[model samples]
Target chain A: MDATFRAMLEHGYNDLSIADIADEFEMSKSSLYYHYDSKDDLLVSFLSFASDRFEEDVLTAPTGDPMTDLEHVVEKLLPLELDEERRAIQTVMSELRSQAVTNAAFREQFTDIDDLLVAHLRVVVERGIEDGSFREVDSTRVAEHVVATLNGARVARATTNRTGAPAAVRVSLASYLDTVLRGRR
Target chain B: MDATFRAMLEHGYNDLSIADIADEFEMSKSSLYYHYDSKDDLLVSFLSFASDRFEEDVLTAPTGDPMTDLEHVVEKLLPLELDEERRAIQTVMSELRSQAVTNAAFREQFTDIDDLLVAHLRVVVERGIEDGSFREVDSTRVAEHVVATLNGARVARATTNRTGAPAAVRVSLASYLDTVLRGRR
Candidate 1:
């Protein structure tokens, strides 16, 4: 999967080929074809694998604090600062997302990932509300809003890092909790 | 430009050709080449032309209210609601934005459009603040957040409309004005 992702990063979606993925994977095309029938099939599986890793490594990398946990999710998805490898990954993911617009297979993969993130966010927000740590706002709405902001930040960061857009996603989420959804207020 | 944009909508960035655009425009390929050196050059020009049209048609569309003015801008961009034609356009624009990640020309075009929108939003927020209709918040930051949310909403709308993501963008913006940034509070 890493090899496949790396290949996609080097040669974009349009230019990438199964042979390229096979070369990166250090495997024969016939063996690769035995596992996955087509390039789209392999790519879809790759997206699913990436989603699983996101769930394991990032979402589950938690602190006890709900706000902190949510912030971490956003940060993991889009770093306030990115090194070369992470930026390359983001650029490739951006391309995949663009593909998702019209491709039903990609769309389903994205939807699954989006649904997972939003569900986790809803749980955290609801936890805060139940514990009396946060004000009564619609948890679902807040979750949806946060996910959208994260997606927006990804797009913004891809074009220009100077906007502080990624930082603002964290700030806006935190500030919403402090100002609009603070129980103490 | 319309022919180019329409071709993009029909064929997408990956598949679109100069011949395709020229066919749509009912012009000779050489004539089109006389104007635009390559497909990328033509697409970039189309983006610039779209930006100009946005600046003229939507930005200058008037209402007495600043809040209404801002809403109009978002609506023009994402259309809180979308018909098939609008959705198709949004999908093509999404592809262009993805291309912008690696393409400097597209990057500059997107940045220009983003900067223009954000600057207009800042002015509106500042105007509200001066008129004593809003609380003191960093107008620039507010503008950035709004732009991010708008971008996020565009992605969300392209997928599942069930999330109410478009409505959420508007709701978040209005709620910011009414709650956190309310002077009376």
Candidate 2:
């Protein structure tokens, strides 16, 4: 999986081939073929692997404070500074997401990932509302908006020359949380 | 350009070829080649064509009312109803945007499009603030947030099973406008 991810970041999704991944892998080409039938199959498996990692890393551990948890998720998804490694991962993810427009296998995995993120966000919002940290906003709607904005910021940061987008969104989201989500009482 | 658009929607970006475009074109494949050298050339041309259409349709002819003008841009970008035609176009755009991650030509075109949209949005926000329709806020930041959220909503609607995402974003954005942008006076 690490080999595939690294190879994908290096070669990109379209130019990447099984041979490239095999070269990156410690195992031989024959052994790689024995595991996965085709490039798409391997990529599909990679998506699943990435999804599991996302679930474990972003969703599993949440700080007790609902607001802090929400901020944590936002920071994980759209970090203000985006170091080289995280940028590479985001580039790979963006490439895969574009494929999801046409490929059902990629789409299915992305759907699951999207669902998990939104669900995690919804739960955090609900917790905030229940614990008096947040106002009485629609939790599902808030979750969707937060995810959508972060997704947009990530895309802009990766695909365009908008290097400051993630930071802009971070500041905007912080103000949004303070004014819109925070409870008066 | 019409033929290119139709052919892209029918065959998709990956499967699309000069022959397919020729089939959709009114003229001969030889004539099509006379205009463009390769499939990538034709696609780059198509992107410029689409960008012009978007600017003329969405950015021009704004209402005198700043708030109404803002809504007009948002509605055009993220309509509540994704009819068959609009959905197809959005899918194609999403595909092209994905390509931008790996392809420089596509990336350049998309960068222009993104800049145009953000600039138009910033002008609208500045207009609102000047005309006293909106509160004192950072016009550039507000514009970026609005565009990013819409972009995110569009991606979600295209790639995932989140059919209600556009509508949800529309509602959320409306509320955001009311609370955040609207002037107290």
Candidate 3:
């Protein structure tokens, strides 16, 4: 998986080939082929692997406080500062996402990832509502809004290098939480 | 520009070339080359052309009502039902947007388009505030939020074929406008 990530970063999604992945691999080409039939197969597997890691890292260990947990998720997804490696990952992910328009396999993976993110967010919102930190709004709707905003901010930042988008969204979302979600408080 | 759009819909952004565009053109390849040096140049010009059309169609002829105009902008951007041709166009645009992650020229064009959309939205929001149709919120922030949601919805709908995302977002945005932006009303 690391080799695949490195190869994608080096060659990009369009130029990346099985040979490239093999070259980056410590194992033989046959061994690599034994695991995945094609580049797309390998990439699909990589997406699943990455998704699992994201789930484990971001969703599983939620903070006790619902608001803090929500903030943590947002911060992880749309960090104001991205290192070089993170930026490359984002670029690669964006490239792969574009393929979802034409590729069903890629689309399925992305959809699953999005669903996971949204479901996690919904859980957090529900928790907040139960704990009296948030108002009695539609938790699912709130989750969707947060996910959409984060995704939009990430897309804008990645494609246009809009350095201020993430920060601006953070402030806007903070205000939204204060006014709408936290209204009961 | 029509030929470019047609060719893009046919071959998509990655597989599209000058030859493909020329094939779609009524004129000779020589004439096509007379105007643009490369496919990238042609695509950048097409982006500008599309932006102009968008501005004229969606922004120029406002309904003289700020709230209505704002809804028009959102509806045009995140239309719930996409025809076959519109779906193809969205796919092509999504493909091109992926390129913006790496291609500086594409990035610049997209940045300009985003700026235009956001600026237009900001103006409508400011007008709404002046007319007391909307609350005295930060117009720029509201505009940014609206654009981000629309962009995100488009991306989600195109990539995942999450057919309901656009409608859901439309509902969410309406509620947001009611609670936050239309608080004054």
lDDT tens digits by residue: candidate 2, B60-85: 77678988988999989998887898
Tens digits of per-residue lDDT for model 3, B146-180: 87878888889978856666777788888787778
> How does model 3 score by TM-score?
0.96
Please rank every candidate by TM-score, starting with the best.
Answer: 3, 1, 2
Q: Least lDDT summed over 10 consecutive residues: which range in candidate 1 chain A?
A: A176-185
Worst 10 residues of 1 chain B by lDDT: B176-185
TM-score of chain B of 1: 0.89
Q: How accurate is candidate 3 locally (lDDT)?
A: 0.84
TM-score, every prediction = 0.94, 0.93, 0.96
Off by over 4 Å in 3: none
TM-score of chain B of each: 0.89, 0.95, 0.95
Better of 1 and 2 by DockQ: 2
Q: Score residue A137 of candidate 2 by CA lDDT.
A: 90
Over B1-185, each residue of candidate 1 has an lDDT whose tens digit, in order, gives 87898899888899998888998896566789798877999999988997897689767854667777777887787665578877777788888888888898998898888888888888887887887776788888778777887788788766533456678667765665566556322
Better of 1 and 2 by lDDT: 2
Query: lDDT tens string, model 2, A6-100?
Result: 89989888788998999899967798999998788999999999999999998867678998898889889988787888878998999888888
